[model samples]
Target: NAGVIQTPRHKVTGKGQEATLWCEPISGHSAVFWYRQTIVQGLEFLTYFRNQAPIDDSGMPKERFSAQMPNQSHSTLKIQSTQPQDSAVYLCASGRDRGDTQYFGPGTRLLVL
Candidate 1:
């Protein structure tokens, strides 16, 4: 398996701009997770997918934050009207089951200007 891959290792966006981050999970894995990491908040769960369906998104922001699992192996997270408060390391993880240990990809760091 290829583990997990995340593109655009770093992103810079101006205030009010939009930004998108991509992720590709390990082959055959059915669970994927998104988390945001910052010095103050630590790691905050954003959303998750199981069997290509969203299972939980309770941790996601009510506005401007969205996540999608378009297929079995890939997912994306988009942030609209990017703000300085949105700057963080966006991490993608995947595993065979919800309780299984997840393998993390090198995160995409977003910097809002």
Candidate 2:
């Protein structure tokens, strides 16, 4: 079964460090979503794309967080100057379209110390 793939299932970074998370969406899927899960926030939507173009990122942090889809196969989420509060499980999901059922990756758990 094809599914979204997330690299570096776990990451540990010191405060002020930079963290980059990678996601590979299911082949042929046109929509991708990024989310963050934390004890305080629970699950929070970060961004989403359609046809490899950003559709919305209003949920993303104004600073320090950025996401990009340079191609149809992959997307990346980067956090600059990572703080302890940035620690969370980053999730990636892919779907054929915005309304389609999204398949999620195993997620990457990041810890900032």
Candidate 3:
């Protein structure tokens, strides 16, 4: 299989712009993971899905961030009203099942001016 695929490897948006990141998981993978990387947070687990069902997303900000795994093969993370603080590398990963080792995609880097 083609591993995980994340589109728009890089994105730049002005403050208040909305950013949408996309991820396509590996075939037959039932678990998908999302992470955000910043100097402060290092690597924060934002959300995850098991069998295309959202499992947990406690790390995501309640107001401006949302994640969706509408199907087994793909997921999306959308950030509304972006700001400079939102600039970070968003990573997508997929695994066989819960607690399994997740294979990650290259990543989508967001730059907010």
Candidate 4:
């Protein structure tokens, strides 16, 4: 079984352009998480879902960045009017639930110029 799949391993866009990233969680895993990593903030939790329902998203920016789990197997992160400061490695992970260990996928590296 594929542990997790993150599409578009690398993305580059001009400032103000939009970028969308996709993540397909492992089969049977109910919890999916999104994170952003940068030199300043390090690894920070962005959002998560359990049984396809959003649970937490306190770390996410109020605007431009959003994450959603449409179904059990896949989720998406969308950023609108992206800026250079938005460039970072976005990670997706899946696990049984909050207390269980989550498996991380190779992060999607994004660059905004």
All candidates: TM-score: 0.97, 0.97, 0.97, 0.97
Off by over 4 Å in 1: none
RMSD of each: 0.7, 0.7, 0.8, 0.7
Write down the lDDT of every candidate, Cα atoms only.
0.95, 0.96, 0.94, 0.94
lDDT of 2 by residue, 19-57 (tens): 999999999999999999998889999999999999999
lDDT of 2 at 26: 95
Checking candidate 1 for backbone clashes, the offending pairs are none
Give the range of the ten consecutive residues with the poorest summed lDDT in model 3: 66-75
3-56, model 4: which lDDT tens digit per residue?
Answer: 799999999999999999999998998999999999999999999999999999
| Better by TM-score, candidate 3 or 1 | 1
For model 1, give the RMSD to the true fold: 0.7
lDDT of 3 at 54: 88
Model 3 RMSD, rounded to 1 decimal: 0.8
Error at 81, model 3, angstroms: 0.4
Shift in Å, residue 39, candidate 3 = 2.3
Cα lDDT of candidate 4 equals 0.94
